[model samples]
Target chain A: MRISVDSDRCVGAGQCVLSAPEVFDQDAEGLVTALTFAPDPGERDAVRQAVELCPSHAITVHDHGQGHSQGRDHDHGQGREDGRGHDGVVVDDG
Target chain B: MTGAQPRVVDFPLRRPGEPFPPPRYDDYRRHPGLVLSYLPNGNRVWLVTRHEDVRAVLTNKKISSNPDHTGFPNISDTMGVPRQEQIPGWFVGLDSPEHDRFRKALIPEFTVRRVREMRPAIERIVEERIDALLAGGRTADLVADFALPVPSLVISTLLGVPPADREFFESRTRTLVAIRASTDRQRDTATKELLRYINRLVAIKEKWPGNDLISRLLATGTLSAQEMSGVLMLLLIAGHETTANNIALGVVTLLLNPAWVGDGRVVEETLRYHSVADLVSLRVAVEDVEVSGQLIRAGEGIIPLVAAANHDAEVFTCPHAFDPARTERHHVAFGYGVHQCLGQNLVRVEMEIAYRRLFERIPGLELAVPVEELPFKHDGVLCGLHELPVRW
Candidate 1:
């Protein structure tokens, strides 16, 4: 599984870094960025916690077989039932 | 949705001779510690109305602001909303760790140095509004003309949004905070629109980084897209709305009590007496804690009534009266303890400039309408007059 951050929703609260320092780091302005991580089953819970703990509710994860667009598109306002997503950006799922 | 006893309640009963139904500080002092009150829903809450008790409750880490604990009322509980769903969650709602992180990150922008740098610009905005009010000629509404615009402009500038968006943000904020949005659809639509607007702005800032706070936020790698959006929403609500009400109500308080303006210490007293934010953002019981003699269990909600606390007779002499020299800094106007407002010093500077410039420039600014008829959104989170009509 791989973790991803929807930059649009990140508020840089730094909770993610506190929860999983191996996965995240905060920039000067307090926005969150993902760090290098070798995906492992043991880390799913950590990633999930980061996702849930985000005050901005801005993190998501996708498994290797699952297409990034398929698994996490529901978030970031993308792939909704109404089909409009993050800042109205339409995802092109082929 | 659960009908548990409200962790806290407002009895609506006030002592005799008080302007509002709730009793003044003196009444609470006669019966100190915690005052039990009831909400219409029948939730029993412990209201700490005295300065000592309010301070005790606020500083105690045992008092958690988080809502996950069943006994703790949601921060939005005052409005009676449940935790699973909330209107663009505010940072103030989070307990330590998350709360500390968000607040600390935003601290730089709200610092005295940073806020003071905006003073010239703030003064300019204040002057322009005052000028327009004068040009409009007699009977201008202070709320719209002076109070609202000052903080709205400051916050907009901080976010790099056009000042023109003030009307939209203001109306949206009113709907979110007002009691009239009885239907879920209405509330949802407002929340959705606000989220949509902030989302779009966040997107734009990502592409073209402006010098505003949003751009600074975009550059930070610490937050995810969703978190960034949440922060924007939080800033929109806390950064401007609260200050606007403070400015409006504070002005009204001074106008209603003319003697206040002349007092050598009107600034401090005005902040204490007519503090615009009636309640500090609610905090949850992090753990079982005791204030004075009462024990509040972990997860229970404790609302420190700053207005009531400011007037708590035990803390101050003649707590009900608007005395200019109360000789106390116990006022919870900006709240107390670890989360006391980061923007407070800036608020003081803004208020000082606002009052000083108004009196100095207008010379004899006074209310044009009777205090009773003045428009006040009675049920708003930040209680203040809708339109403070005033004339020179």
Candidate 2:
């Protein structure tokens, strides 16, 4: 799995690092720093959870098998049916 | 539906000096997203009690944070001060691109990295306050001696306010935040004085820039004098006020629940249990929207009872009990969505250091007066103790 972070949109909520510390860490300012763009198979699930829980939707994940990337643009103005967002992004409010 | 009018619960259901009332928790559990009429003004509003519903209302774009909208729920008469008449730069009341624009400019200054870099200084401030508290005999008013000053000094250091002016800003901010304690005239006077002081500081910064937030903002040349003053006032007041209360309240909570005194989870649980700014996050519906199966019409107001939502039994098991072991960190104590608090990371660091050091240094600390005898700040926008007299 490949991962990237949009530093411009990050508010440093620290959800990413909390969820997937192996793949993501925070700089001194609390902004997300991608420690590993390519994660081992064992770390994929945690990475996915981090991407979904990011409050700013700053984390993006491209699953090799899925052949598509998931990020902010993919989710439009619809609220998340599950009632959870990338960190607390509140998917429905977009 | 019956012909009888639906029960109208007061907007701010919690009373001063009380944990969120048990009945309110029951109300939230039973009616997660019920529309109830707010008292006094009688504005129709959705009382979002469930955590999920509260998140939905907070994050909904259709729900505007702009308090200028008609029919917006006003929890207190003091809060009803006209928007235009009130001091500007309170971005909490703005919506959309306007809120985003200002928030964007300020985000970099509060990033985790920046807060982490300041941790050493914050630790030093916390240590110094403890030192002062110890030197002042065996008894002290925790609020004045330690709780209030630690964050006050930290914020002053960050803003680059000269040490000589620290006492002035601190006193003004105390009056400004204590809406119930201070008369409206006093509030107005304090605000005007603070704004004038910031403006003078800004002019000085223009002539001789320094390595501080004010100088940095002036150097950008983005905000006008009034705008800059407004931002500084908001930061100055907000910087110390909430965290100060948290520190005091957190100590009281830890003393009551000694097992959780030094636990890191104590901070999260304290924030969740108290939810200090209980009724302030009022949003007006700018467009028709449905949340938690309720259709809220446009122009209606919504008040997310954060303390109630935090105690919702469905999300938190045994919600009423203070269980620091529970690891659910999704509490909306600092708010959520686009307007989630900008200084939350800093608050976490401050609280963690404050609690750890206080307990480690003064393990025998105990309240001098009974908790019931302590004065609780009821009239203010935030809920906290007026003074916590304590001894070791």
Candidate 3:
């Protein structure tokens, strides 16, 4: 599974980083921007919370291996995305 | 369908003496006992105006403040909203047990001792804001200059709300509090924006542990996500809006009566006379109880008019005028009884320091605009000056 953050909603309050330090890091402006692991199998729980705990409902976690059944969509605000449909393959964006 | 209605009409819902006049409600003083007809929605309700009656009703649990009851009227209808807009959600609407429990959880954080420990930090925040105000020039809008920043800095620091998010909260609060929003659409829009902002902050606090109130709550797991949002919403509204209004109006009161600035008696007098808290917390009557010979049925809403109570002649000799030396220990500014404001101590210390430093730092401080020209949050449940322009 992989995670992507929507920059518009992030307030840079550093909450995402606190939930999952291994997965997210804050930029100079204090906005959470990127990931530490390409395919961090060990940090799945932290990544799940990092998305759930975002106040703005800006982060999305995508899962690839188990088809549509692999990851339950955590109904945050991210609806459908045009990016890669599967998880495991990491999409790196700053 | 219902039993015979009580003699609600005979209660004489109007004040008795001369009106309070401009800058003060003209009709508030004259007919202290007069119950004015006020409708928050389509439901007809009576507003109790006299000090004694308001206090009696506010402290009485028999008057239900909750919106779910048939007797309780919806105040959010003015904004044309379907569901009632729970402005200060959580305990603001609760009665007795639920109110007591939720408030108890956070009471320790706001105690005199806890707040006193924050004095040095609060003082520093005040000094910095003052520096910024003076830096901009000798003259400034007292609302923006002093009133706005004092509580903003204090609350943000205490809660560990990030510094960058401060501007967002400030802007959203200003928009939401102004009762003068021309249309219901505008008011609703502002409300949604503020709620969204708060929800975002809540999400952040959950993940990131800090020394703020939000972080503390997240760590303990005492409150659910919904409950936490409700409480934070209360803090955002109560913590800053009330304090900001008090500071603005307090400055106006002191500047108009300069003697009150330094005189301990006068400051006390100003607090009573020009109370920033125009209305008292809403109390819902849980059961039918008779007060002052009137049997107000169960579930009816009772609002304690703090302004009216402070001026009750039965309670004080000359109630209307601002007299700092009055030795009366009982004032309803922070309210009376068990559910009084938890942040009262913080508000008091902040106001005292703000006023003391304001006048001392700028000796010639005086209003730049006429009192008549100044704006106020007149129609709001909690009323005070909107902008206080001053020059030294």
Best by the lDDT measure: 2
Q: What tens digits encode model 3's per-residue C-alpha lDDT throughout A61-84?
A: 655543322122322112333446
User: Which lDDT tens digits does candidate 3 get at residues B1-392?
Assistant: 12333323321112223232132332444542334335544444545545546555655545655666675655434423344345443776776556655665575567445677899988898888888888998789888667877887788778776778877766666665555543666667866886777678888877777777788767667677778778876776787878888788878878888767866454456567765564445554567665544545566655556766677677767777777777563566766444556677687778888888888888888889988778765455556766788987
DockQ values for all predictions? Answer: 0.02, 0.23, 0.01
> What class would a CAPRI assessor give candidate 2's docking?
acceptable
- Using Cα atoms with residue i matched to residue i, what is each candidate's TM-score against the true structure? 0.70, 0.86, 0.69
Model 1 stretches with alpha carbons more than 4 Å out: A1-94, B1-21, B74-89, B163-191, B259-264
**Per-residue C-alpha lDDT of model 1 across residues A1-94, encoded as one tens digit per residue:** 5556665455444446656767876654445678844446666666666664453445655444443322233322122343234334433322
lDDT of 1 by residue, B246-307 (tens): 67776777777766674546666777777556554466665666666676666566667777
Query: Candidate 2 chain B — worst ten consecutive residues by lDDT sum?
Result: B78-87
User: Chain A TM-score per candidate?
Assistant: 0.60, 0.73, 0.64
Better of 2 and 3 by DockQ: 2
**Please, what are the lDDT tens digits per residue for candidate 2 over residues B1-392?**
33334456656554655554346656654853465765566678777778867777776778888878887776666445433334466677787677765676676677666778899989998898899889899999898788878877888778887889988977777776555567879988988898788888889889899988788777667777877777877777676879988888899989999988778988888888888877768888888877766667788888887887788777888877888898566688877667778888788889999999999999999999998988877656677888889999
